[model samples]
Target: MAGTYSVNTNLIAKLAELRITEKDIHACKLPAYEQSGNLVQAEDDMFGRTQLMTPATLTSWQNLKKAAQDEGITLLLVSAFRSIDYQCELIAAKLERGQKLSDILSVNAIPGFSEHHTGRALDINTPDCEPLSEAFEETPAFTWLEANASRYEFGLSFPRDNEFGISYEPWHWACRLLD
Candidate 1:
């Protein structure tokens, strides 16, 4: 071996990119996420795997799944709890790909401001529905969630033109403990 070489340009690049102006940071206005209860990895379902979530949320989710199954609606998981670091990396990749920060923010949440950070939010879909699309609202699973998820203390995070700048995500549900 000749000489060992070490480099960390990637880290440097990340830090440099994060050196955003006050206006830019203000424009982002990341969401505030709250955490409660112990987060545990969700039990695998028919659709796919899940990330870690609160045990209470998990129990409600399991119950929701059972009810959906009983009604012949097998809900699928598109996403669950995601760490802030992961969100940062995801946004960074999008930014690197020449996507506008506003455009990216319209869809994905900024690291510290994601509902997924609370281990309470989850994205769901059906095997027959398009993932993360409005079409999901037309699916039986969405309909089931709409009709019954409330019983499990789950509710949709967004509806078309609700308030937050983020786009409507019909598949995104959260189990917020009303305190």
Candidate 2:
């Protein structure tokens, strides 16, 4: 489980030669929306539109799903790990669509600043429930997570209106350990 900042010596030297200072290294954690590594037991085992979660994230998500199922709630994955290049492409695409870089970075993380870089985050949804919007934080799943995520070693990286600068992602969850 290599982390986002785990760069090789060769790459380090190359970056140094380019005068890319540490302050310039905008290493974003992988977003909960992008899938990566082996988050799921089966590669294709998606709850809905989301896919490509690491194994650890998938295990925790499954546990949460089972608990929800037992309580008559249906949970689904909406998105999960995007590659660095993919994210760059996304940013480029957004800019092409006329979105300002500053505005985009405010809501969408700048490539490396995303938590998905760590392969520990996930985005979830509920079936027959309204698709997750900014207000999804008020839903039962989000409410359930507020109380129960800690039991599964999962946590909400961004809480409601916290001073973290990053926007709140109610559907996002991350593992406490790689596992």
Candidate 3:
């Protein structure tokens, strides 16, 4: 994975701007992900925002969604591909809102380190639940995903006590790249 993605100077500067040090990067348990260059538009999210993902991820997500639907569950996309710049903006917004940097980093990955940059990660939800809340774990959509998402090559990225040190995110899943 190290050889797969090289962090550029701009990203380094951005991390510095966010007050993320080399020690912070080294402490992160998750691997850095390169932003996908080959991405296609996926289905519009519940908010009607267009999402993008790698072609294989899009196909797998569609299959997973269809299978869930067949089982009387509905999966809605909340987020997909996100650029390093977008990641920076998210962190900056949180910082401006007075959130501690450490708290922010625990949830949102530093720019260039987010799995969302890979275009294979998805934040999913079902109707009647908060989009990114831990309560999703109790929903039928999450139960269906836990039992069946692997059939489409998707798996939860961060679970309870995950080594990534990220918070438990029941709504986040990522597709395995066949390539």
As for TM-score, the candidate ahead, 2 or 3, is 3
Which candidate should be chosen as best, given TM-score against the real structure?
3
Q: What are the per-residue Cα lDDT tens digits for candidate 1 across 43-116?
A: 66445565778888888888998889988888877778887667778888888999987677677754555788
Local distance difference test, each candidate: 0.72, 0.62, 0.89
Clash count, one per candidate: 1, 26, 0
Tens-place lDDT per residue, model 2, 62-179, is 7877887787766666666656556667767777888876666666665545676556776766655555466677677777778787888788878777544566678777787675
Q: Tell me the tens digit of each residue's lDDT in model 3 across 1-179.
A: 24224667777788899888877877777787788898999989999999999999999999999999999999999999999899999999999999999999877888888889999999999999999999999999999999999999999999999877778999999999743
Q: Give the TM-score of candidate 3.
A: 0.92
Give residue 133's lDDT in candidate 1 (0 to 100).
88
Error of 1 at 27 (Å): 4.2
Which is the winner by lDDT between candidate 2 and candidate 3? 3
